[model samples]
Target: MDASSQDVARALLGWYDVHARDLPWRARPGCAAPDPYRVWLSEVMLQQTTVAAVKSYFAEFVRRWPSVEALAAADEGEVMAAWAGLGYYARARNLLACAKEVAGRGGTFPADELELRALPGLGAYTAAAVAAIAFGQRAVVVDANVERVVSRLFAVAAPLPGARVAIRRHTDTITPSERAGDFAQAMMDLGATICTPRAPRCLLCPLSASCLARLHAEPEQFPVKAPKKARPQRAGKAFWIERDGAVWLVRRPGKGMLGGMRALPDDGWSARANGNGTPPLMGPWQPGGVVAHGFTHFGLDLHLAVYEGDDWSSLTASEGEWWPLDSIDDAGLPTLFAKAARLALAEAGEVG
Candidate 1:
């Protein structure tokens, strides 16, 4: 947008040309076209998650679904199961909605970053990521990586939530036109690997000479933020029932948390609930250990109770069914319920 911004983008792109990682979403020189679907999927999965953690999830998802239409047609339960352990369960929900929408529109995601932002889960960062990486759009993208890179280069001193606007404004001025994708990746890689929050490798950075934080000898202090508030904890109960070789899993409500995911049948999980309580299910329920799950907003404590009997009772949803608790991996549970299932089976000795 401005002269200085253009300079920053140029330097970052040059550095990226020599140092960028050969990521899956990228097209190799002289190879075929880069898949927009892969770029979109990876950007969606990488929200608030690290690249290291997303690699396997990305590969598995692409392997399983292969296309937007396939993902759209997939059962919400299957998507939830596939997404288990990747954390940010809400992203999974939005992923389904966005995918279905894309399918309904004849399965074509808009190449423009702004239009991409309108999709269910695609935020500013994700939209920029997909647009620049997949469509080579000249969009200024500032993820955690870009934030660190920007903060250090400009020596931004304002506290976060408050500083977001200024940072975005600054970034908007610098994004380059050609090879915009590589420039975006470069800033991210620089922040992630070299311009780290702690003990940045200044001497190794290409822009070290221009880095204000390095000049001031305080790179760690850039991108300041307000102190994080303590997350409150909530308690609930999960009913793990085993009838035979199959373990019992009920479909979670299709609207709320972990909606449409396969889980050990649960009973009313309010923010306030009795820790020592029986779920609204029939059979002899034994007390299993609790399963603790950390969410972005709060921590949840699930008291896993085991029921071993022939009666299904009212616990069965219209579509709820039984599976060998041992076959949970095949059922596709998200991380929360998967952890509960493991705890329940271990405590109830169903796995043995």
Candidate 2:
């Protein structure tokens, strides 16, 4: 490592020693080194999610399943439910498969980055993270934080995709010969707090003296990324049918939009729904309010369709469950479906 980068890393670690946020899974003194399983689970859940939101979910998961053995033994549906509100449904799905795989492999998570990357859904960055944080291996961990930090430190202006490689090369140099986990975590914390996307606290930053962006008095301008285009809204229809206090929810197909998650009855396709927008339900229907949801690729415009009949026994969907409204919170409905369910039930009650 160059003397300048070494000084930067040392300064940043010094700052982290005092300013690092209290997060779960951090190794503590003499308390059975943090479980790699917990570390792996938290990292998967925390991807594309903020630390504040991850805290509660992490606590809930650790409390529910204390170890890899317990998580491996858990039902897929239950794991999905526990991870419901935290978006990225696919991660939840992969989490189950990976847990099971790790358990079957003698309950030992691979310490080598190559072996970790070979696991299901473990990408290069994530593999590097697990290798460094879990086993103290020297590896480059480039998450959004590291990207922003590197972008500003050297003022790399190249667009992403092309820029990521250069940034990765830079990160590889300063990762250090030891304390790999703390260095990676320190970089993440520095990015989140000091080198934030907007209005970075440049003055308080430990590496500010050596930061290129700080030298130019525009640390926020480093690591230039292309602007995002406007998200197009796509339309869909959802059904709302209830009996007693139970609302009907069906398992979305294992492939495609919101795959494998619990959702309301819907027609074959989201838009037009086989034609005329009537979902997979029977009897006369009422129009519930439209519920708006956003996915990674496009926005969803889902119209709630409700059918209320006293002869509830006469109406049945192909495959679904009637979950009590009171207990529906535990059914692992994604945010989008949960919002739709609320609207549908409200409209159903008004018409009934």
Candidate 3:
């Protein structure tokens, strides 16, 4: 690395020694490297999720499954239930798959980024993070935080998704050969605290002396992003089949959106091109209003269709279980379905 790059790393590391965030998954500055399990778990949980949201979940997960092997052996339903309200169901599934793979390999994670990438559900970003933080490997760990920090440091002007390549190259230049973990965490802390998306505290930043965006006095404009297209809107209906103080719940197909989780029956907007908003069985259905939900690619307006049929035999023909109405919260329903359930319950006067 060049002298200027070394100076940047040194300054950031020195600042980190006294000003690092006390995250649950992170080891203290200059301490021994954190456990690979903690690093991997925290990294996965932190993806598209905030540190505040992940703290309780991480603590609960570690409390229940103290080791990777224990998590691998956990029941799929239980895991999905535990992961409810976390927004992304796919991450929970991948977490199980990755844990099982790690457990199968004698409960040890690979130190090499390439080897970690080869494992189930371990993506490029995750592998690099695990290698750098867990194994002290001098790998380029460019998370969203690093992306923002690096983009500002070099005054990258290209819009994101396209600018990622340039950001990675700049990050590589400043990544120190030793103490890669500390450097990675320092960048993350810096971005989360001082180098915020709006009104960054550039004067307080450790690398402000070398920051190109700061020199230009326009750090906020460095990480330029392409305009986002409006998300498509979808319409669907969910069946709220209540009989004898119980609600009918079904397991979604094991491979699509909200897969393997318990939820109310619905027109397949989640896994189809278009939904007709038809009920599962022929019935004089009552409208339970609409529940609007947003996904990564689209937004949904799921209308609730309450089943009026009294014949339990006809309902039994379909594949589902009748869960107690009072204990609906215990079921691992995704946010969309959970909102639908609340609407249905309100319509039924079951909840205030």
Q: Give the best candidate by TM-score.
A: 3
Poorest stretch of ten by lDDT in candidate 1: 270-279
How many angstroms is residue 302 displaced in model 2 relative to the true structure, after the best TM-score fit? 1.7
Give candidate 1's error at residue 297 in angstroms: 2.4
Give candidate 3's error at residue 156 in angstroms. Answer: 1.2
Better of 2 and 3 by TM-score: 3
Candidate 2: tens digits of C-alpha lDDT, residues 298-334? 7778788777555566445667778899887788898
Q: Rate the local accuracy (lDDT) of all candidates.
A: 0.80, 0.82, 0.87
Candidate 3 per-residue lDDT over residues 209-286, each given as its tens digit: 899998886898968999998878888888888888889899887777878888888887753355777677886877
True-structure RMSD, every candidate: 2.5, 2.3, 1.9
Candidate order by decreasing TM-score: 3, 2, 1
Question: What TM-score does each of the candidates earn?
Answer: 0.90, 0.93, 0.95
Candidate 1 regions with alpha-carbon error over 4 angstroms: 1-4, 270-276, 308-310, 313-319, 350-352
Candidates 1 and 3 compared: the better one by lDDT is: 3
> Which portions of model 3 show Cα errors greater than 4 Å?
28-33, 270-274, 350-352
What tens-digit string does per-residue lDDT give for candidate 1 at 264-293?
766666544434565656567677798888
